[model samples]
Target chain A: MAEIHLDGVAHSYLPNPTDERDWALKPMDHVWRDGDAYALLGPSGCGKTTLLNVISGLISPSHGRVRFNGHDVTTTRTEHRNIAQVFQFPVIYDTMTVYDNLAFPLRNRGIDEATVKVRVHEVAEMLDLVVHLGKRAIGLPADAKQKISLGRGLVRSDVAAILFDEPLTVIDPHLKWQLRRKLKEIHERYRLTLIYVTHDQNEALTFADRVVVMYEGAVLQVGTPQELFETPSHRFVGYFIGSPGMNFLPCRLTASGAEVAGQAIPLGGTVLAQAAGASVLEIGVRPESIRLADGGAGLTVQVRDVEDLGARKIVTCRLGDHELKVKVSAGQAVPAERATIQFNPHLTWLYADGRLVR
Target chain B: MDKWQNNRAWFMVLPVFVVVAISAIIPLMTVVNYSVQDIFGPGQSVFVGTEWFKEVLTDRRLHEALWRQFLFSGLVLLIEIPLGVMIGLAMPKKGWTASLTLVLLALPLLIPWNVIGTIWIIFTRPDIGLFGATINTLGIRFDHTASPLDAWVTVMLMEVWHWTPLVALLAYAGLRAIPEAYFQAARIDGASAWAVFRYIQLPKMRGVLTIAVLLRFMDSFLIYAEPFVLTGGGPGNSTTFLSIHLVKIAVGQFDLGPAAAFSIIYFLIVLLFSWLFYQALLRVGTGEKR
Candidate 1:
């Protein structure tokens, strides 16, 4: 029910952080809108967990303030913040039955037993845990225990948000998609502000409406999955999001065209003008955006290998010292030894010092 | 390699068998042998069918001692377990202070058993001891040697002071093994400190607490040196626990046959209680109706 704001929030575990390297989370401002399914996506050591803890009020940020609906709550305790968090592993009360575990948060708030019973049963039914309501939680299989951890949060009607810290890491591989779809259904039904943290790109792309990509303790971009795929605002985002990722080549911008790794590629005048004066320039094209030409229609290249992946194929080509990949459709006939790669002009982009140029 | 497959591996185990027999089995069998016989001298004994067991089972003195033994062990467990867990909870989680506190707690447990008794005698003697002098200075006539209640109190104090550290050490280890995520989840669930202890910390600690309970129970049940040296079963046999009474029978009266019978009964009683305690502790929250 709350829209959270992180205003210049940063954290460092050291009491005396003399340099930027000591900061676990660099300062940034963000707003997680109410009722949105957001994913904080990054690899390990990217400070996503630190940021999640800040929003949950587990750790007070060393810098800047946190606000809910524009009210500063930087000093609030976790329980008082009206938030719930599920850890990476299941955290169940070993002595309590599943029903009691689900009822814990509501009972702690002094809810009446009748209401607690209703909410616990409803959540158990939603989680497909009704059959286990009478069983002790500790000895249950990991997936069921994890459901209890999440159920405790769902039972609290007044919680502002429920955060998940890689809650599906321990689930069986086949069960992961089922549980993920269940979470999406729950989000749609209740419209809770759900912020999930994960390092897997597929999970982040599917579960969240907005994927906040981070790297090296810094958030690189925040966008929808389509926007991230079509227009990556940072080079790292372009490299990290796709299956084969984006291919980059050192290039020189000119008045009429660009020279890419000792080969000339013609560009529109306006496109060349925008990247006219960059000290460091590179052309980025997605594997899906590049086409293979057998008669050398575009930039000439040496074919390295072609790997078929069911419906489509990935063509690995070499341009001077640079290796480039092109995703060809099922109908395209590629040469065995040599093929020219022509980047689709609209999908190609210019990057200066790892940042996307418009 | 297949020149001959001899049974030399069996010979390797013979040495261990001999060691085990000499250390444990032989002495145990000797006690069992004496429990059912009337020994007059070396190689001159008569088989006495279940005579000594029947006599020892009905002895009034032994009955009183058995009751006292149960009371002592019950009080020991009732006092030490919670006290030790609290101490474990209060201990620092990390850094130099945690190690320092651990070393301080272990200091009492490291003292020799008889030395602990001698130390308590010096500590509780009515005239020259600081504790006794403090009571006398307060206008109270208190002497452990003369009063049965005072002797029991002093003996209980010495036992608790000496062995509570073992329980605390085990509890501390259990607490440390719990992952930090459980505490975080508890806080997020709005659980109070007491609820966290009841639901999370206590449940997580049951494994170690079971061991602690059994160890303290059996040790306190078989207690001999500390109370024996401090009170000498004194003040009209008020502090005569099972072991002290058994010693009085076997050594004081030199009635080894009945003493051996009494020892076997004592051993069985301890084993039964320990087994029952373990089963009850482990079954706290197991299954529910389908």
Candidate 2:
């Protein structure tokens, strides 16, 4: 296990990072603790995979250092950094047998044949690939080959960390759950430093201990799933972390209350102190946090549509002219034509520009 | 749009079949007819049961030619396969450099086969040609016109120059087909350079390598033009490969009966060897051959 420190690391495919637009991965500082499971979570082209490659030593940062176990290894080769990576697709050797594929790294390290055999069998068993030890990898199905790739990464016990770059994206949906659980189990047993990169929120939240949320090549926030859901640092994080996402209603803050669509919603004593003197403010609320208010005390909305998601119903309602979505239990009753929904001020957040308002 | 009808797909292949029959089947039938009879002139012929086959099978010249053909094919395959793969790996992966290298490599493959023979013949003349003059000035006593070893060397070098790019192009296509994910995985696994090449690159290249080997083998086994022009069956027939010997029998010496029979035997040998290579490759490609 090793702690990885990214000290102002930035990367660019072209030399000199020509301008602000030239950077593929924006400069940032982060430290991933040893033996901690972390996920680089963001949408595609958000530089999550780029960060993983940088950590694996595949691409050197255009600026700053990557220190592992307190050793500066920014320019070191990938092999010397001791990282194991599982690609989005299976990358096992097709001509070699499953056993040979697993044994390849160990053999390359000049380990004894008996030790290689033992370690190969150990990883094969962990991955449930023991039965396929003699079968050539080329004939295996995609999922099985992916497992062999996983096993190859796991076979070496002395690695600094194991990085997975959306390894479950190529896997079938039905099988993805099992692989995630298996990975979790391996991390628990071995206590290896594991970093998983994915755009899927559930995969990231469920697999990693702490999730590093990124957007447009910059790390937004590093926190647990609950923290991200409860309090997002950036507007993009609030919008990206949930299904049916968070809704941002245009509003202005006053010394006493908040103004929304010409209606001054009283900030109620508790929310007033929080909303005091914010220059540019937008009210943010999760769909599930908005509840239907009885007797028409809250903002009136037109019921645009209702989607029955079996587990939960999504209520798509229009607040003034902006569409707002709210989640409720499946088969929940709704008022016909128009209704009023009260926003839970405690769960809702206020953001100024793109950042959270203090 | 309507769903695709799988049953009518056979109609798409009719034109191809007709073209192949006209080009291949008709000529093959003519060769078979010639194999079974003796031609006295362009029109006169006599039916000869298995006499021509017997003559070809017992001939000492046919045996020596077959041996020479095997040696040439073996040497050519040995030189081209590894050289081409290395060149393919070393070529730039992207941008203008890759296109420039591809165009340069493709130049040799574009030249006509007969032109290659003629060009080599002129380029290696003992007195005036640069290659021959350079070797003679170095006091190497190199003369393809009079020396069997020199003749063999010249033919082998010419064949290598002409066909190595074909293998490299195929191998390059295979290498490019590999996704960046595989290399990422190799890096994460802490795999050394040799291990990555031996396991990932070699296995991925197996399909292309199979095709390259079969093509080199068939072309080298039936080699005719370049060596024929440079040495003309050699000063003592030392560089006389099977195709050159067969051409001499049917055209120069006009031993039509025996030559026809010998041509069939030669074709069968090539067909059989290629079939063996194909079978081995199919097995390995399918992960069932090994």
The model with the greatest lDDT is 1
Question: Where does candidate 1 chain A have its weakest 10-residue lDDT segment?
Answer: A269-278
TM-score of candidate 1 versus the correct structure, residues matched by position: 0.94
- Residue B36 error for model 2, in Å? 1.4
Tens digits of per-residue lDDT for model 1 on A1-358? 8999999999998999989889989999999999999999988999999999999888899999999888898999999998889999999998888989998999888999999999999999999999999988887998898989999988888888989999999999998999999999999999999999999999999999999999887889999999888888888899989999998898887666778877777777776667767788888899999878887478888899989987899989999889999998877888998777778888888787777775
For all candidates in order, the CA lDDT equals 0.90, 0.86
lDDT of 2 by residue, B27-67 (tens): 77788889899888888998998899998999898899889
Q: State the DockQ of every prediction.
A: 0.74, 0.63
Deviation in Å, model 2, residue B264 alpha carbon: 1.7
Instruction: Residues A187-229, candidate 2: write the lDDT tens digits.
Output: 9999999999999999999998999999888999999999899
Q: Fnat for model 1?
A: 0.87
Global local distance difference test of model 2 = 0.86
- Point out where model 2 deviates above 4 Å: A266-280, B1-14, B284-290
